[model samples]
Target: MTGRNDEGAGMAGGKSPTADTDVLVVGAGPAGLATALQAHAHGATVRVVDRREHRVRPSRAMMLHARALEGLRPLGVTEELLNRADTTPEARIHLGRRTVEARLGHADLPDTAFPHLTLVRQADVEDVLWQALHARGVPVDWGVEFRGLFHGLTAESGGVPALSEGPVHADLQDVHGGRGVHRSRFLAGCDGQSSTVRGLLGAQWRGGPYGVEAVMADLELDGSLDSGLLHVAVGQAGLVFLFALGEGATWRMLATRPAVPSPDARFGQLGPPVPAEEVARLVRESGLGAAVREVRWSAQIPLQHRIASTFGNDPIFLAGDAAHAHSPAGGQGMNNGILDALNLGWKLGFASTAGRPLPELLETYGQERRLAARRVLALTHVIFFGEASPHPAARLARNVLPLLAPALPMLLRQRWLTSKGIRLLAQPFVHYRNSVISRDGTPPAKAWPRPGARLPDASVSVDGKLVRLHELTSVPGIHLLLERDAEPVASAALRTLLPAEGQGPLLHVHRLTSHPGQGVVAVRPDGYVGFRCGETDPVQLRAWLRLVGAAPG
Candidate 1:
């Protein structure tokens, strides 16, 4: 692929410094960085740009949900992040000064491997991702922004460009008065809501700002508070969440106001430098009034939810907040964005490297992510309002539901409105069924993804040494996990059905029955389960692998 400007010279010409890369990523936040990292691993030459001169001070998205943690495990940073943050096994729900705690470590939910939520500052998480990207030799051009994008056709020697017939070119600009141009097979918009890339693509973000407003701050408390439980207080004063940030320090507060008459106008300017008195009042209302101390950072944010109508427009695609934005009620922003990156990263890398038509595959990004986002929005509303059911019957049920918390474990289990909460609370990962990458098969039903929907992390004995499931399947391709002592016919079938050298990895078959009774599963690069069959059928397995860009030999 090639890029050039005949329009003018430098600033006068409205032309930017022209260069070529496999993929051009906008924004250096968690989402952008994660995309670049994944693309690089897939062997795509990547150039990541951001408008910020340096990493921003952390504020939102401190709670790492189980789904996000699972996604990060493959990136080889989950353990490091866990070491720097506090893990809360309990989610405390407060109603009108009454509190009920749900132990998330319940035995019935054992199907999910990651049961606890890890609380770490967003800055700390960014630092770990940045370090990983840097160590891998991927360059992030900070202080640079994606100005616009244009398309053309050309031949290249590196990875296959997404636009098989021609190369895709992108127009970029530096914040410091210089224009930089990048030519690549594809481009990704990891920029947050109000993304320049999304604007350039002319995609519409349709949704209203939630009528709720809140102030949040990070601080060191004067006294110790239990870091193992997330403390929430809900009342007329609104909802306040106190999360543990480790040490004697804590994420002081995130407080929400009741829905307002004018959603935009309700965002009151809390003064240039937040007053210490106001901070104290917020802490007091959060049930931590006595332990208030020096403030580290604070800001006011209004709740807003929106989803982009499309995630991809040909060579350009969107991920993270760029594709969708929602209220912070469930702490779903970062997790959602990271999962988006993981979904698109492998496909983008593979398409760019292997000469394949990516427009069809790229179209799937919005189809899959938007559905997940919609579900999350629905679930968040339930959590935000269901705590106080509007219907008299539902309200009575809520009151009575707690009473039967013991014997009603079974009845409540079936009617459990909480699974919606858990599904919405967990981060979502996109897999082959959502894209052109997977083998041919009827897509699974639209309920929460089963084992085939998301990846599962297990601590198993590998070669006589303990290792993670992700580490065992580290190649930048699809992996096939078979039960030990299975028929050799199954292995040959997978090879024939999957691409021999497509953007996705060929089959990496591992026998798991050495431990006995373990099920068979296949994992995608983005850490989602691709396919699983207990009793192997060569034809059925072949069909499933082919749908995800795999061909059994």
Candidate 2:
């Protein structure tokens, strides 16, 4: 808001302290912190604000898919998360009397450092991001409630309705009793579903209640529910899922039943609140044999699946849950939101430094993410309905599902089929094929996946020493990995295109000798390969840069 809360590297990283910052990120959750950190890394001065003074309590997000982990790598937070999270490779779904289990491991994919679903509370993830942001000279200003835009509107979403707006002029109130108005070149609504930014912008959030309600609680379990195992049981009483929460004999318990009251109804459509007695009863009825010694926290959440019609408008943008909401079936909500921030941060970083809001670049954020969210929402819906529907076929599958878990290996030929199943649960397969920024070119035979996919991490030798591909490429700019001709060296054209040390264009060039005869791969800051072509072909390189809006205009 005012300089009283601003003491970081001015937004756009080096900009001097001013009421007009480059990027004012709202909410300090994974999405918000990620947006702030990535923007800071790109040298944009950033201000991160959160209405709450603390991290999310009773953490909701519990799984970090491979793609999400990869997205976090550049932020310097993924490795720490890897060290702390539990790697869950398989889940046993006990439907009726059947136990559907399969080996769900990520190790089969060599590109992923942590192939398994990293299980850590969302709070821990935020802590890691927050610590990194703090180190970068940006700290989260907690307990600041966003009121509204300062210029054109007169309404406070949080309190007294007083607002105005032009561009992204924002107003904030320090819960400790101070109010100030400020403007950022760009503002991100990384806040939760009830996003102030989204509401003020009047963006349409389409979709309705997911027709399901799930009661959940985290508690010390009976240890019989082994760590790293997620078990789901569906019966006439509805669906119950159980999974361990790190150590301390604690586990998260959930039960989803048929639709309750609608948010518009007198009862208000939400997860009908569940008491400890109800949780215990649901657990016992599902035959999940875990003694709940103590309950830490519990709530009834009406599962929701909604996506914003548009991601953002000009100086204002939406990300994370604020942009899209997902059904909890695949645990894709938080991860999808994180990826959204990842996609937008670099673009904003580049545009902010260019001294003007790049309209096309800003517009691409909504185009890419809104479409991606549709796919995720659709996928999660099928899975949710398949397990919870009352139809006969759906019922038959749920009943016979667990029985196949044991026979999957033999029936589907363990290695290949199980690996495919595991791949479905991970995010490595997602690509921005339709993105205006993602281009394609003739690729080498050695490339495992096609262009537009996040470049797979590899180990290559440079200067006679082995170096990880990520180590050199994980900087704040575009990275060019030109395959060497059996030696560690870059072609003349490749070297010519490289920027002088610490200068404009934010380009990093490296010659990788491990994959001889391969072409040059240009990777975006988000780590997705823009395109690949002959190592000496500067034309293709220039084209890729322009496509991603990274080339010199």
Candidate 3:
């Protein structure tokens, strides 16, 4: 039973929002917002919807990692994130009287613009993103709930006559029980762990929950905690972690101590109210002895890890928490999820608008991101079990860890004297070496990354102003990067391949004489090398471009 309200057609009466859009994005959380922003930045018409009527104030993820910031910088939202977030450079591990501190400072890692972890409430991050979206004329439609999915043009709605083939329809309900239907070329589900879209699509998750149960709460406290570093205390009772919320005497405390698991008013959902005694006892046992003046919010999370078998079901694709769920141990969930949107955003943006055959483009999103999530799940699993496990071996290790804490910093400084140490903690190195779009067959005359590897953000001069290499590729389409010496033949060949009227916005031609390599590189909008020719082989480069949907396919 559904009410079909006439006003629910769209924000305007001319055309349904979904019908006008190339894609419909579900979920208004961080990942959904990022997806919408990235898609729009890449020149695609997008509409976003979320079930929730209001933005939640409670923090889900408190730390934004370096790699996420790097990936997001192209969208021009990084500056605001930096302005609002608190920077932390270290994580200290304390065992009774001994301590070992590791510095995650950005100063030591020169490869990225955002070198350190930024501690801000997840709400703040969302606020900044929401503001950016609104400022750019892309408004998030709140209170609209996604109810059901339809294939092609349904007879009941019969909306948007132009949409004839390969269109997906979504049934949406308003807050007042009003119903409407919208159509799109694709649907992106950035929903959470309890994803309605994933459930409707019948995609199964392949992992299980962690064994440990913990209590996390944001509280105003007074202790010897360093606001500039993450404080971890390991004892026989259990493990305790303190992360600064970038506010005065307020921190998010994650602890698993010798206590009973909390029983919430609702089962399987976080943000349940906990007994005062449980919160106090847990903190007292952490050895921090910080008094909880006020508890803004509390949650009892039985950490779970889940990854969908595939990221999508044809026209229905999953991103963000809907695609995968993991422990908050490494602070990788939101960051990794946002990165996933960046990976798929440009692909979807171009594919939806290309109006031509992009045979291998759309499917690569699942192939590349699904594999990355598997690796992330493995890494975060180890981190949670090692740092927060309640095992007998873990208890024993906690005791011995203090003895080794004294020499840990010196070992880091002396042994990790190279870039390897810093790079280890960064996001996992992701490259789609075996994906069909990856073509590493062409050997370069000069040094260059393979087709599947990241296109390094080399320093280059644009319009006589020095800028990072990513700035050039951030524009909408394929970028042909070549050294000045290699440009004569390379540019001529590309010009001939392009139509006589001149190139469409789908391809950007750049010849940087400042670059040191004599090779030619075809960088995709998502910043991966689609093709590379080390030598002067314009013919092979043209074929590679055609294969990547850059040329007429």
Candidate 4:
């Protein structure tokens, strides 16, 4: 079910008749759209499919963190996101009698372009990404459902003449029951928590539902609640979160109160509707002074914390909610999934188009991201437990929250503490230093841009124009950034050591006069430093490139 023996069959030479596309992405949500876009950006032909006949209008996830924005920047969608986003810098936390403001902006952190926790409906993001895909001439095959998976060319229904080892043949059915086969070098499952692909791969989905139950509704509210700030109300009753949606509904509310057990109440799925009066009552009780004029949509969400045993299953891989699902405590679900797509996108592009076996390169996608998901799960678990648990300790913490309100402003005033804390929540702190693809040719102390860490943004002159370091690495392929004084090699000379023409992503080299003497940093397509060295040694650089399949072995 894993490993490829005929890597060259579908790459380099004229398109192999065995496969219809390089990457076939299932599910057209945020993750799937991002995966397809990233793969396409990296030179892979992609196909996207979603089971729904039309796009969903409801916005499930509502926050886009800094790291996800950084990851999506290279795809040319970040500007639009910023334009449409609510770049609110703070959230007001209400605790019974006291209200405190928590900072959500990057005034304290100066390394990234995205400066705040962007508040935008998930539907707007999907629309932007789908539009990007549309501009690329890659349309989503809506109403097409992924039914089953088969390896190689022997799959029934339009089977290829020759049997191959690498490509995946997936069975798909349209809304009308028309059946067909989609053959691709790689298949990505961006399906939701109830993932058919994860089930088909037999990956163990570990974990269970959270004891807390919550209801989410988008309502037209007539109230004095500040429309510019995210609102959080914490009490022994439970947690109530409100956001100014600014669209179909005036505000969005997510309240975690013990569900009233009605015989007709449905638990997990979209709802046995939460009553209008009950919705208004929850808001009123939270002391937000908001009256729900109209409930646009309401649903009871059964929260769960779970992750798959493996992210990649050979030619088949899972991303987004399919790979992991956790409490929306920090609003990490959609952001984590977007970052997951960025991690796996370029890897799939390389594996499908390298024209040579790249087992190590392919394997790192799962190794790096699976561990990242585990860490996110741990973080969200703690936050969710603190916010929703009925334990004495949790109750004490909630009761004491108001007492600490006086200190909140003082704490937020500390630039270092606030920056570090916001960076942690914003996800710029996530790194893959231990990944196999990350290599350091120098001692840790000497590694200025540490391998496996995100390539930090720095202003430097590129051909007499000042540009951020990330702008240089934003393009598809490997970027070798060198200080003018550290490495004497010409950009043309460095290009000679990369993979044979057309074998892999192009290796772009830049010599910046203003770049610090950090030796050489080869940034990966996903904006992480894959290789870093104090001095540019051809042997070391070549070895690192070859290790990551960026150079011919």
Q: Report the Cα RMSD per candidate.
A: 7.3, 5.1, 4.8, 6.2
lDDT of 4 by residue, 411-527 (tens): 877767766765777765578898888888853325356778887777888667899887787667888877767556535456665544554446888877776664777888888
TM-score of each: 0.76, 0.85, 0.87, 0.89
lDDT of 1 by residue, 1-553 (tens): 1112221122433454545788888887778888887777665778777776655555466777777776666667778888877663565655543456665433233435556556777788888888888787666766566666544433232332345455566656555466545777777888888687777667788886655556676667765556667776654445667776532245557766444455344222221334567767867765543467777767666556678888876677888888887666677778888888877887676666454454555676667677777777676666655433244554465555445445433432452444444544674433335544433223321222344366555666644667666567756566666555556676665554344343344457776544443235667777666665555566666655444444422
Lowest lDDT sum, 10 consecutive residues, model 2, at 8-17
Pick the winner on lDDT between candidates 2 and 4. Answer: 4
Error of 3 at 86 (Å): 2.8
The top-ranked prediction according to TM-score is: 4
Better of 1 and 3 by TM-score: 3
Clashing pairs in 3: 444-534, 445-534
Off by over 4 Å in 4: 1-19, 151-164, 259-272, 442-447, 463-465, 486-490, 494-505, 516-518
Q: After superposition, which runs of candidate 3 have C-alpha atoms over 4 Å from their true positions?
A: 1-19, 152-164, 246-249, 257-269, 412-422, 441-446, 460-467, 474-476, 492-506, 514-517, 535-538
Residue 234 shift from truth in candidate 2, angstroms: 3.6
lDDT of 3: 0.71
Q: Can you tell me which runs of candidate 1 are displaced by over 4 Å?
A: 1-19, 89-109, 150-165, 220-229, 246-251, 258-277, 286-296, 386-424, 427-452, 455-476, 484-507, 514-522, 531-553
Error of 2 at 230 (Å): 3.2
* Candidate lDDT (C-alpha), each: 0.62, 0.70, 0.71, 0.77
